[model samples]
Target: MNEDSTPQSSTEPARPSSGWDRELLEKLLLEALVEQRKARRWSLAFRVFLVAAIGLGFILAFKPLAQGGLTAPSKAHTAVVDVIGTIAEGGEIDADTIIEGLREAAEAKGVKGIVLRMNTPGGSPVQSAYVYDEIRRIKKEHPALPIYAVVSDLCASGGYYIASATDRIFVNPASIVGSIGVIMNGFGFVGTLEKLGVERRVMTAGDHKAILDPFGPVDPAEKQHVQQLLNAVHQQFIAAVKAGRGDRLKDRPEIFSGLVWTGAEGIELGLVDAVGELHQVAETVIGAKEIVNYSHRETLLDRVIRQLGTSVETALTKLATSSPRL
Candidate 1:
């Protein structure tokens, strides 16, 4: 008989194929159970991690208390508020933040005096005015509490406007101080465009709408109007200075002529009261001589979000507000 043609047995049951063998099945079941347990543990761990991260973020966002929560004072320490940076919206130093810090100092227990550690080359006139108003308001509310402006570097223009509201201003000998002036400055590319054979297409509904368009010829009438506007603001600045400084300011022609002077000259010119440092001023103001900062600091995440919003708003308003610097 050919082996290829041989038939299989009929009565003998064929051995079952490998399906769900007891040992193999048991092994697989054990592995699956173990994997499920591990998966559950990992899921629980991930959930726990998320919860912890969220709680931490919340603490960071709202940790500083209402009354100088950043630091607790032991005695009647000199509460210091920093006005360090350009006095403008969206900067480290601004009306809102400065006022917030001032409020904190006002509310803080046993705060002897408030020191404004100012360092700025000036910025937005409106922003500076806001801060100045707040300072005056605070001073009015807390007449007994002394507020001092201690300049570190360039305390010019708007910086001076804010400082003028303080009880007294102390500056380092070489510090640049004073710029009690308002200015409007921008560039005109009309001549360049004309030479380049380019025509600027502009349309406005109002006569003075396109007043200082950089790409077009500057209208003399518009220029005069803008100068008058600057002079008005300058007058306001001068009034603020006079109101704040009172009779301390010397009657000098160059005092408010947009000229900056050294701290030593500022004293002679009566733009500044005295020459001193933070520690010395603190010691002079408060009995304890211990100083505590009460500045409103933006968190890292908060700053990023603020900048994003500000950048978008500025981009939208840039063309509309192409006027001078403040």
Candidate 2:
């Protein structure tokens, strides 16, 4: 080696033997952490899948028991179709579902009679009319199969409208059983908006399109037009009640004045045929002690969704204008 050229020192530090082992341990720990995360995710997914599967199985198991037409009881039985909520489209007590249950009960084997188990505060007039017409049709088709309305807590307005179509209306003495009229209600926020210095702007294709706007002043012409519409619907309601009840209903003006009445009062007014419970009616009236439910069963999720939708709709209706209801 030349005297002037000294040996060059290593620029890099000499790595310790433990450094490689430390890196390997760190890599292994990271891999273990990744595996743990993946495992936890899979476990959560499995739990969710298991819950969903159990729910599906539960629904499948109960569907046949709820809907009884396909597999009705062998012995004599009275079929019960529930009308136990607001009568509106897409509701638990909608016309389509009720009609389906009615048809099923009529077609079921060894069905002595069919009963409309009513407990509702009323809802859509159109929904009520659909059920009423269907009941009449079913009565015509199965004249021998006596159909009755058995009132529970309440059967008012649209509920009464449907009950009128039945062969007889039975109720407990304290049961509320009448409200044979139509109603349309809304708010008038014009004054409030004006006071608040807020202006409402609306665009409509026709002059009368916004006649029912909550933020608009009520025009006399529009009010009269709305009154005429209400009167027309009211007349239709009256006609249906007359046709169904015939001479059964008393000639009382208040009977059709949107007034609610107790079961006892309803009986006196010729609105209810008798005061009785479900079992009593089934045993004594239909003479079929064995009762089978034929109502559509809504799952918990379905009921939750439906109730949420109804709450939203009700809120919206309150904010805006409501259509005529019975």
Q: Worst 10-residue stretch by lDDT in candidate 2?
A: 317-326
Best by TM-score: 1
Which is the leading candidate under lDDT? 2
> In candidate 2, what are the lDDT values of residues 108-177, reduced to their tens digit?
8999999999999999999999999999998899889999999999999999999999999999989998
In the range 1-326, model 1's lDDT, one tens digit per residue, is 89999997799987975766877977888888777766765665565556555655655665554333656575778888888887778776788888888898987888888899989989989999998998898889999989999999889999999999999999999999998888777888878998999877888999888878888777889888889999999999999999999999999989989999999999998999999989999997555488888888687655655565565455445434443221
Per-prediction TM-score? 0.73, 0.73
lDDT (Cα, 0-100) at 173 in candidate 2: 88
Q: How far is candidate 2 from the true structure (C-alpha RMSD, Å)?
A: 11.2
Residue range with the least summed lDDT across 10 consecutive positions in model 1: 317-326
Candidate 1 RMSD to the real structure: 12.4
Give the C-alpha miss distance for residue 2 in model 1, angstroms.
64
Model 1 alpha-carbon miss at residue 192, Å: 1.4
